[model samples]
Target: MGLEIRLLTARDTEAYWHLRLEALEREPKSFGESAGEHRLSTPESATERLTTNPEDNFVFGALLDGDLAGMAGFFRYTIAKERHKGKIWGVYVREDCRGKGIGRALLAALLEKIKACPGVEQVSLTVAAGQSAARALYVSLGFKTYGLEPGGMKVGDEYLDNEHMMLKI
Candidate 1:
């Protein structure tokens, strides 16, 4: 099957929210949140998020066998101190779809969009320190760990370390 990458639209609000919450729930250790954390958001929140910046903040999704198995997004760093960079987030592939190059495709597509952003010189993301597979993929894509944060997040009963990484374009 062929892999297709496309921009997320208003029509994808529910799917986007569902897939992201699924990722956060399924891989609680790899993400910043626990399964129950996202319950605070209402459908309005999801729609607002989807509609606010569909064009500037890009979300690239990968379809495998007619199903969307992975997604990644990046938002331009709007602060004056970090205007030359974008922060990547919501990067995840379905559990059954991992290791099949879908994650790579999703990340590459997001990076390409980031590179096209005027004045965007780098992309930054924080990954769970113990996620070696994701870390290796970032390295292969030219991302380097810049530093580490201790007890960055508490997922359920465990505190996880976070590795800050960046890719200079």
Candidate 2:
């Protein structure tokens, strides 16, 4: 059977936090910071993110046989000038579950969700420069490279570049 993709709700908070921390711990380079940083956050913080208003942001998950395998979400800009855009973040997939389209499923679901939000005309995301598979996946789904941020993130003693990508909704 194929993976099941759906929009997450408040009831998913615990599972969402578990998988999110797992991603941050196992693949720190894939995201902006380390799980250790979030470890300092209170349970309220995790629940708040998972329960964010769907009108402003929506989180989607891809479950493989009822197990959360991947997740992604978007935060719509609040500024009047940028209200037409949304920033995609919190993207992750288990290392062992990647390449099977879970990432694509999560992205696609979140994309549709954002596209339906009021005033959201575009969606943007950042991917590591060397992650060709991720870049290709985004490009194939209609995102285009808008720019590159050199040394955008520091992982321990190393710096990594990131590519800014956007898709018009």
Candidate 3:
């Protein structure tokens, strides 16, 4: 596979939006957003999401043979007291592209960019409690479990808990 990991831009809005919707549809439990909600979003909104502001927020995409196979996003907290912390969100790799290192590469690239952001002392993320593979990958990348949020998300009548983790840079 001709794999490439790079920052996503406005030109990548369509691919990013499609992959994001796929993630929300196929792995609803893994994401905080619902597919229904995403379906209601406009192309302009998707384009805005891909707008890169490195010091504040950005997304990294993993392309396999020029096709978007995975993506990960990062954003720094805007609150004055929380400005030193960054959060990782919307991480997903296509089901057909799993078992490869696409997730790792996307995350590695995101982390490298995060390290360059001024005042970013640590990175944090939440993984659904049942997602062992995702949790393992985060742990392998030096994130430590800080706490568990009970009922972090709800899908229909079911509630899913999330494990909060952080990596101090």
If scored against the real structure, what TM-score would every candidate get? 0.91, 0.93, 0.97
Q: Candidate 2: where are CA atoms >4 Å away?
A: none
Tens digits of per-residue lDDT for model 3 on 32-84? 99999999999899888778455589999999999999999998999999999
Candidate 3 or 2, higher TM-score: 3
In candidate 1, residue 147 scores what lDDT? 88
A best-first ranking of the candidates according to their lDDT comes to 3, 2, 1
Report the candidate with higher lDDT, 1 versus 2: 2
Tens digits of per-residue lDDT for model 2, 1-169: 5688998887887788888889889878878968988778777777787677768877888888888888998888888998898899888888889888788888878877787787788889999867777778888999998999999989999999999999888
Backbone clashes for every candidate come to: 0, 0, 0
Evaluate model 1: give its lDDT.
0.81
lDDT of 2 at 120: 84
lDDT of 1 by residue, 1-169 (tens): 6778877767777777788889887888887655576767777776676567654577887877757778888888678998888888888988887888888888878888788888888888999868999899999999998989999988767878999999889
Task: Using TM-score as the measure, name the better of candidate 1 and candidate 3.
Answer: 3
